[model samples]
Target: MPAIIYVPFGVYIVTDTVEIPVSSRVIGQAWPQIMATGSKFVDPLKPRVAVRVGLPGQVGVVKIQNMIITVKGATAGAIMMEWNIHESGQGSAGLWDTHFRVGGAAGTDLTVKDCPKLSGKVNPNCVAASLMLHLTPDSSSYFKNV
Candidate 1:
């Protein structure tokens, strides 16, 4: 069985992170975006990540398509998506037609980080500052117009 989740066309305001479980594909309408409240400053030590995927023992394909992620007023984490590291038999993931923007704050940007999977390669400067999306080791993910 295949299941797909949809985010309606419009701007949604959120203060906390949104979690998408495994084995599901999240689709957006007209490039819907999730905007974080630009008033709160995230802690540099423990920043609030925007999206998280892959729960424990989740061995099904996951996808995120057609969306724009924006963040402002963040001290650290900013607008970022995290992929949990699996032990074995990991499921595949794909990102299509997605865009990430980091601006509007004093000094903040979007970022994607997985410490367990990408430990020694990811630039510490990217993690500490700026917006970036880093792929994992041996990941068969595809991206288009992102």
Candidate 2:
């Protein structure tokens, strides 16, 4: 049997697509968001918040930055990752509206492809992920804004 992890609480994030570096290039991708999450352990662990399902299309990455969140206590403690200190976005359709999770914490990781589609249609291409992660020491991680 597997360890039954539960995300009894969650925040909401929404975003749109725009241009990058004065050029018109849309960001559309299919990747499982690996948010820098912390778990209860002497040595830090990336306890996968195995979201048996995934986020919805209506939910964008922008909203994730300002989501009101609450964390359920893990073995360590109540850990929450802020979206204000990192860069993140939806792999597709962002209105130059990318953002970083001020704080990053452990949660779910999955794409529309990994879960059931709430849009009544199931197209792999239409699937994308919105992840919140920690920015590197260098600021070169973010996408150049136009």
What is the C-alpha local distance difference test score of each model?
0.58, 0.25
* Candidate 2 worst ten-residue window by lDDT: 14-23
lDDT by residue for model 1 (32-118), tens: 876654433255455555666665445557777888776544435554665542323333566788877665333234334322345
- Structure candidate 1, residue pairs in collision: 110-131
If scored against the real structure, what TM-score would every candidate get? 0.64, 0.20
> Which residue runs does candidate 2 get wrong by more than 4 Å?
1-65, 75-79, 82-133, 140-146
TM-score for predicted model 1 compared with the true structure: 0.64
**Candidate number of the best TM-score:** 1
lDDT against true structure, model 2:
0.25
